[model samples]
Target: MRITVGKWFQGGSPWVWLNAGAVAISLVMVVGLLALIAVRGLGHFWPSAIVAADYRVPGQESRQVLGQLADSETVSGERLRGAGLPLDPSLDVVERSLIKVGNRDVTGSDFAWVVEPWLQDAHYPENVMAVERREWGNFYGYLKAVREADKTVATGDQAWEVFQQRIARALAIHDQIYQIEKHDIGSINARLERLRLKERGLELKGNATPAVLAGIQAERAALDAEYKVLEQQLGKLYVAFNRDSAVAETADGQEVILSMGKVVRAYQPNAMGLVDKLAFYGDKLWEFVSDDPREANTEGGIFPAIFGTVMMVILMSIIVTPFGVIAAVYLREYAGQGFMTRSIRIAVNNLAGVPSIVYGVFGLGFFVYFLGGQMDQLFFPAALPAPTFGTPGLMWAAITLALLTLPVVIVATEEGLSRIPRSVREGSLALGATKAETLWRVVLPMASPAMMTGLILAVARAAGEVAPLMLVGVVKLAPSLPLDGNYPFLHLDQKFMHLGFHIYDVGFQSPNVEAARPLVYATALLLVIVIAVLNLSAVAIRNSLREKYKTLEV
Candidate 1:
């Protein structure tokens, strides 16, 4: 029981405690970061009570303001005075707040900073309404009246009900118009482009006969007729789109008319109960994930980005797995333990440490420019000069990521192979099985869990990569997904949106900083969740494989 300090140090208890302490610290930091992101991001969906206040700054007239309180900070009085604000000499610190006054079209600003002491008569009015628009950010005001064209349809207390009904009608019409334009007309446009390509392709090969030309012309004419019908329907829908308008009185008491067709939704946060707020929050959260982005990606859903991120990761996994496994097998089972093989293994390990951006540059140069350009010239000469495959797209992005993650897979697979008892392989060969047969049936199956582990690591790394994707395929906004209902459904040559890239664009490239900030947090959280789900799925498969082959290992 009387152990000396030197004896205790020799026992290694301190090192064990040190390692556990380090792990605990790391876990706390990770959990704390995720908690912060969830709070800041998910809190954006909950409706906050809009405050109406009379604010007056030094050397300015007092004006009525209506908006949500976004954030607050304490600053030195000296700093405030340096910014030309008059403050008491005795004051050491002052509190300032950022308000999201969302009449961007009228006031020409999305937010305004006010000194807390100068804010007078701050209150939440039940009559105040927050309108989510398809354009111009958000509109905060009081409902004045509902009008159909120049005629007043409803006024006073009934205008809110009438406005809601008209908004529902407008949204329904919008959905119909969206279907016609994006789906039906989009399909026709794609077909027409293909026909043009076909004609050009024939001309290049000196095979454009009169009958062939006439057939192409006939197809074009049929598409034109269909387009014309959709065009007429769209013309009528446009007329309906702007049919109803709502008159609203702003915080400044100026009346502005907003088309019901342009309104996404309207809410009175001051009047909403907990249940109503929860419903509103759910709707907003769904829209953030399912709807198309609007207002320069500061508003709307990131469904396209989500689709592209998942699609590219799946493709990368498919490309990297087999190649990694083969290379690992060759090195571990067949290749001699020579200097050249040792050099190669060292090189492979070094490659994993190389900066990811360098891989992106290599991918852009080799995969996109060299190989894709050659393919375009040799196999798709018709699409030449336009550079179909030669451009940055989905295929190149996937290949680039696959190349980036190959080292991880090879190392993991090799380790797994090294773990398989040599006696097992010897037994398989002794039991009337050839070397190839032993590898195919016994070795590979037992080694599968390792391949899955490699794949899981690859997915974890590839899904979060933004720089390489930016150079190869990721775009700010993709008009349509790489996948569609067209022939040869998955178009790997198309550029696509990505969640990581979207977060970058919205967080840094957006003009509306305040509006984009919360969205950045929310999108980042979603990206983490996506990577987690992918890794967890891979992990589940890996565990299952391990269980199935556990007896083989014994």
Candidate 2:
């Protein structure tokens, strides 16, 4: 048996099996992790039933609790007693539930923990509504009435219908207001700023004449006229939207009037059938991916973060590929394989192992501070003190990440170039092709797939990096996207949001921990999906290239 095992090891069969097992284990773990995240995160958007129950804690007042049951657990009775809660000596364990009692404006918190023994008369009422708001997370209450500027337009069950109709109107009006303010007014602001820069440029050149000044003034007047018209339209819409309100009664019988404009969506989760809940889930998921974040990023969506992440990765790929390829070509194709070349390779390998935060620090000092400051002084002297390019923004961030992942690309490209047969290069050179021409057509085409492999790895790393981005550019909330309906639409100097940083901020930095936890899981899963999709795209391109050039290999 020992001889047989030794022979197996010598044949490399055992090692192959061991390596396959390791890869299998890794694949299983990755799938399991993604499954866990999807279950925890995607489940959050499904409309859960709201329960109204009576609770009586020992030596405390008998009161009503109304909320969604968020979680449940069984704990030792001794722990409860140790925490100063009165408990029976005979009871070894007790069950408790965490309920999402979301009337934060009134209760000061969005969640409550209620012991099962003290809870009674639990019921799911069809009229119970879950209100997603703009300011205070979520509101759970019974719709009592719907009003139009003090006059009750809907009462009891009828109010529910009225509420939905008017809220839809309010949302439409709000969208219009958003477009005008962000798109139209935003354009005017950009034009005005450009005019200021132009004036400053002319002044610097000693050419600030009266006629030139008059032209700038005339353009300003035209923009202001448009702004006034949009402003007046916005004011009227605001009045129209604010005219409607709803009076909702809490479980404690306290009635409060809420504006329709503040509510994002209202749904009766308990009353919704499986089909209804599924539809609601789909809509919520779409909104989460398609809309901008609101309420300190704890409430609405993360479309901006998604857009910023993809945009940054593309920009990084574009900036890094050429530089990395050129470096690799020089080292592998032209330079002699001597001690210096070996030392440079060792340095690049060491760079890959350096901590990511070190790259962030370097980017801040070198890219944002040094190079940007010089560019600002030379080209944008007119916009001084404000620090245009001298600030953390999109272009600097892309360049910083390019530098951070440069080693990976260089290594991959070098490997690919090394794999190409030397005889192929000789054959091309002997057939009337110069060395440069042979490299550009024969070698490069065959090696294009390897360059893509490097890009795939670089993109996978860059998309998930949050540290370097924090210093170079990612923000918690970017009011405007880097690209918009403005001049030079792709504004490389604008600050942007990132999905990885969004996850970090919501998961750790948020003030509302319990409320943010679900979002954290959801955002994390989304980030993973985004990276996977990006990798798959690059992989597809690489596969196509490899297939096309397969005949050249033999």
Candidate 3:
């Protein structure tokens, strides 16, 4: 012990040091990737601007600028009104003015204006205010303002105002329609019920019921005729309300038609006032999450994607856990050693190695075609040719992923089950517990930590998966959420958007590759962060369970 240091140095090995260094480097790479994703993905939630062409008269040009408008202040004899503040006339009064282009006025007029700061490398006519600087509440506030403006223009001020009034009217109308529809539905149901009852009655009588059957047939015909009329009326109302129309008035009080683009520009955010920049970003970030989907990119928010991801993961977990656990239990507790068990083990291990794209093919063929086709035929006869189950949807995607990750969960759970001391099972049985009771109450609980570890691994894999989901359910754009207002509203057969596929589409399929590259990175970062968060949560749960079961240590 006194002289061991010199002998150890003489027998030094470089391989050990090299191995340690490699491990350190690997850890650093992983941590760096995580940091990059968190920073970049979170950054996109903040506000940024895109410069586009401004085309109009040589003296008057129009450009699109995004940001919120500054608060309005009215000057009254050297005092500011509307903002509850007194004006300092001596302080530089920055008066913002927009030229009346094509008979458009600043007040009560929706005209597109580009902020001064956003103008770069673009020529502006001598008379045109190509760039102007104004204050907006935040990026999201700016977006909201634009949306309101778009709606106002598309329907015409009078019409749009009328439409707003009509939205309430529409709700009332909807209720009325629902009542009428309900009545019709009830009538149809009653007729069908009567037909069924008469059929049953005729069977009981057994003597003959041509008259009763004829009466039933007449009732059916009347119901069908009434339903057709109601359907036609409903269709007409839907069309009348759904048509897009906008009104714009010229400076001379002449009105003209406007497109969604025109109205959006006219109603763009007014940036006239400045406030705290940090608060602006913070507010904008919140808005990004809360806003509605826009026409092209669905500008209001990413809420749908967030919702979809959470829903898919939860569903996939629900599907995978029981199946994986049960498989593990059977292999560990019930299955006897033999060629069959060994073959089953090999198949499970091989399943983990198969490329996920293959699973997509399997999902599309089996789940989307075979199983779904059978379901559609058996239950949804009225929805014929629509292929409810045959379409790519969240349910199928979840099931596909559950299958894809099943092997991992099974292997991990089996390992965990194997590690539990046999004595625990024996003890439970000795205390008068049945095999099922011992497994469920004692063995399963003891193995839960390991099971969770497997689940965490599965979640991380599934959360980042894009290949299978693409074939099964992921869409480039979805107009409405999977869960919405309709009969059996949570339509699992409908295609849905996913962050992983969004990254792929933006990176590869986008028209503006350069513009979308940053977005791709941002999305990738988001996916990584989501997976990390899930894994971290699982880790926390595992730690808690481990602590709870610490006394059961082998």
TM-score for each of the candidates: 0.99, 0.98, 0.62
* 10 residues in a row with least lDDT, candidate 2: 545-554
Model 1: per-residue lDDT, tens digit, 1-554?
45787788899989999999999999999999999999999999999999999998667899998999898999999998898888777889989999999989999999999899889999999989999999898999999999998999999989888988999999999999999988999999999989988999999999999999999999999999999999999999999899899999999899999999889999999999999999999999999999999999999999999999999999999999999999999999999989989998999999999898998999999999999999999988887799989999999999999999999999999999999999999999999999999999998999999999999999999999998888999999999999999866899999999999999999999999899999999999999999999999999999999999988762
lDDT of each: 0.94, 0.92, 0.63
Off by over 4 Å in 2: none
Across residues 404-443, which tens digit of lDDT does each residue of candidate 3 receive? 9999999999999989998999999999999999999999
Best of the candidates, lDDT: 1
Order of the predicted models by lDDT, top scorer first: 1, 2, 3
Write model 2 residue lDDT over 1-554, tens digit each, in one string: 99998998899998899999999999999999999999989989988889999998878899999999888999999999999887887889999999999999999999998889889999998889999999887999999989999899889768888999988998998899898889989998999899989899889889999999999989989988988998899899889979999999988999988999998899998888999999999999999999999878987889999999999999999999999999999999899999999999999989988888889899889888999899999999889988988899999899989988999999999889988999899999889999899999988888988999999999999999998899999999999999998887998888999999999999999998888899999999999999999999999999999999998762
Off by more than 4 A, model 3 = 1-20, 34-276, 298-300, 485-489
TM value for model 1:
0.99
Better of 1 and 3 by lDDT: 1
Listed per candidate, the RMSD to the true structure in angstroms reads 1.1, 1.2, 12.7
C-alpha lDDT of residue 330 in model 1: 96
Candidate 3 overall Cα lDDT vs. reference?
0.63
Q: Give lDDT for model 2.
A: 0.92
